[model samples]
Target: MKNLPLSINTLSKIIGKNCIYVDKTKMAYQLICQPGAFFLSRPRRFGKSLFIDTLKEIFEGNQELFKGLYIHDKWDWSQKFPVIKIDFSDGTLKNSERLDKRIYEILYDNADNLQIKLNLNRDIPGTFGELIRLSDKKYGNKTVVLVDEYDKPILDNIENSKVAAEMREGLKNLYSVLKGQDAHLQFVFMTGVTKFSKVSLFSGVNQLTDITLNTQYSTICGYTHGDMERQFSEHLDNVQWEKLKYWYNGYKWLGNTNVYNPYDILLFIHNRMLYRNYWFETGNPTFLVKLFQKNRYFLPSLENLVVTEEIIDSFDIEKINPLTLLFQSGYLTVEKTFTRRQRLMFQLKIPNFEVKIALHDHFINAYTDLVNEKIGLQDNLYDCLEQGDVRGMVQVIKRLFASIPWRNFTNNDLADYEGYYASVLYAFFSSLDAEIIPEDITNHGQADMTVKLANHVYVMEIKVVDNANIDDINGDDVNVIQHNNSALKQIQAKGYAEKYRGIKGITVHEVGLVFSTTLKNLLNQ
Candidate 1:
């Protein structure tokens, strides 16, 4: 115990963030093993702070604590420095007016810790550069800087629209002070959740060496497969390691893929709990809400997704793209990736249970596509469809669409309004746990939808009715009749019937759903 070092506090599950603190002997001495000012961007609660603390212990020359760790032998233990760690997360300034004061507070705290005398009074020296000079003179060593959560304020106000812009500009100026004082700064490492513009922080002295994408450092901030095995081996079963991998792992950076979310995973094992949607409960996105305002239905994009590589890799936050939103927010991950011209060209998907349901809920709350009558619309629709009454289905569907909150279904936001109706109906039936596959690819063509009930399989197609003036082409029109006939023909032509060829006493029916506000209308003969 005498040689163990005070690791108890750092090892606690709840407070220490259930972080295994995967010993990074290689990264512990970034100065010797690597070069340049370091920066890392990981999703929220992914162990950025713990990594920063490890840096503090290593660089402050606390060698006894790191025995058997990565840098214990490689680092010169006796080299101590005037460590001035200023975390941007604590900054409380309203704007640029208090930037100098915040920097001074950081200086005062560091000076007090090192027992260094410094004339920090406004009368003697008030600016950040002045405090740095006094702190250096008080202690004969260079300063090692660590900045954490450097983008919190900007993210917090990102939704206000007006204040968000002002906050960004303010942070830009405050961080600009680091330019001239580069000489006094011995080693600097910054950790934050997102990568905002470096023009704001680096301010042209020495560029931020964005190790966020560098393969060597990609696993530096977040835990890798090996990190999981080595440190938390005791909790392997606790983490449901294999299941955990299915959910939180798949993030790719630089050339390498496969990393885990330390936050959700650690908390999962620490609490020893199994539940639904833990990560989404941690933080809500105002940007996502704003995006929903623009893309109300998300009908087309979500329904027919065929992502190209450029959209996946170059996605930006402000644009409010859903695929990019899911990727960065830790909902979806790159299952596979390809490269062309030395750049990543494509990536596949694999969704975890945590994300699959949240996205479904996101769709529901973000858009009011449902007709909202609550008038037993389901009871009526189900009764009509079950009876195979084509005329009855058409009348009911027309009434339902007329009740639709048409204002919610706007232009590009809803590329396929007909698809929206299908999804809503699917959701209504989903609670019953009936197998519902929309536009199921068939040998013939995409079947609009196929609901497999206890005894029967119903194939249905839906179309939109924009105005009542097109009444002559009502649900009884031949096109409606011919469409259902053609569907039946194709269903038979492509051997959709052959595949299910001959099962024990099974019935197949073709149904046409003409969606409108008049009634829930369907046609079958």
Candidate 2:
């Protein structure tokens, strides 16, 4: 078998080095055939850069690289366009001043590469337009502009909204030239991780078609199941195909086929087909975790969350939707799409098992102070539930909550709410891969959580109480004990376990966890 192209994104290098290059030229040809200005948004490391490089080679008339590829025989070899490429993937541009400087440098370098001289005194936007016009005039062909990581500057400072907005406006000043210089451009394709609203980023550019959700281009960036079987067949011999798919596959973009992340596939093969969170480790989602905590987001709602098209289509800096950020970041993907009330709706969920584990692990780490002890605790929780030891599970959970650093509860009102406690439980259970339903709905009411194992089902409810009076002589009159017991009572009263109890070979366990803010741990029985 040919060598795996581990992290080798350049199309020519993959072809020259005889690395395994999945043939994406067919889709590339389709994209370039009638391109005015196209935009594609995919998660980071999902092969957008490599796809951009492929388009660059195709437009530059690198026919030898395409000798056996799909576009070799069909594409016109004689017609070569002067390709002006702009890539923002190198490093972070933290502010608009630096962003403008980078744009100027890129334009000058492109001009130098194309052997065209540009007036250095003009502003970045003017220089960019001049470079396009001059490249076309010099080469006697309209320029093909391929912008990779087009929104990196903005995304780099997304946490700092002020700087991010400045970067956005600076990018807007540069990109707005595209529409005015439309006559000089043959094709313009820009790829980025997230799509800002057209008015926010694209400015006057209205013709730029967003092919992100277009079904035709859905498989353009990722590896389909057929791709893995056909291209990496030799590398995948004797591998557990089902487990591999469970860990790394299931990224969908409203297409019929769900594709595997290319990064995961490459690393999986290189590591001798071991299953791991290869893609998730490349970038940290600390911001997302903190955002989750800040918003007090419902963790269980991620399982079957339904969103409208408008919510996920464009991101606004002023109001960052946690769900939109999660969806766009590849932590979640479209499980299915359907029409509701004449409006298109999408149901999103965790893409695969790898994400399901790694994401929650990160959350658990951020939620508590037990850094090195996280795995041990998770394993303990898993063993307790696997053996139907409710007491053992309760003890393990108490340890989980008790381990949280006091600093986490100091500055925020997180300690006073049920969501904070329930969210922590949700993360711990979710990390263990127990079949979890948060806010589990039943005929009677919604339980805080429902966990399904092989033969045991855990129906749980959580309550947070200020039980400081439990130590007083007349604490019983304050009803602290009654309040603490009501958590379990609610589960039993609502018949939350009724549906699972009748199932054959299923043992339903009702668990009530009452937490005391003063104790910062489970309430005393």
Best by lDDT: 2
- TM-score between model 2 and native: 0.96
Best by TM-score: 2
TM-score per model over all chains = 0.70, 0.96
RMSD of 2: 2.6
Q: How far is 290's C-alpha from truth in model 2 (Å)?
A: 1.3
What lDDT score belongs to each candidate, Candidate 1 first?
A: 0.57, 0.87
Candidate 1 lDDT, tens digit per residue, 337-444? Answer: 556667765454434556554554444444445535433655676675566554565566555555656565544434245656666556444423345666667766
Q: Model 2 — which ten-residue stretch has the worst lDDT?
A: 469-478
lDDT of 2 by residue, 291-363 (tens): 8877889777776799998888888888888888888889989999999999999999899999999999988
